[model samples]
Target: RQDPTEEIQNKREEDLNKKKKKSAPKSSYSSVLIDKDQEPTQSVI
Candidate 1:
């Protein structure tokens, strides 16, 4: 049987990985700033 604490730790690591992937690249402040700078001339379809 798996230890309950080990299962919880694995679940937490998986959640953190998902969060990191979702928050990569454009989620960085530099990309956000660039998008803001371009907003004046860009339109969303």
Candidate 2:
């Protein structure tokens, strides 16, 4: 049988992993947008 405290800890870790996974794509998407925005300014300089 699993210890209840261990199970809760595992659930918390899973929640953190889920949050990281969700944020990872958002950050990458924003970075891509920033790169696109920078390219035109860099070329103009």
Top lDDT hit: 2
Q: What is the C-alpha lDDT of each candidate?
A: 0.69, 0.72
Model 1, span 1-45: residue lDDT tens = 999999999999999978876878445445556768765433342
Task: State the RMSD for candidate 1.
Answer: 9.4
List where candidate 1 sits over 4 angstroms from the true fold. Answer: 25-45
Query: What is the Å distance of residue 29 in model 1 from its true position?
Result: 18
Residue 25, candidate 1: how far off, in angstroms?
5.5
What would the per-residue lDDT of candidate 2 be over residues 22-43, giving only the tens digit for each residue?
8796664566668786542323
Cα RMSD, model 2: 9.9
Span of ten consecutive residues with least summed lDDT in model 1: 36-45
At residue 23, give the lDDT of candidate 1.
79
Residue 45 error, candidate 1, Å = 30
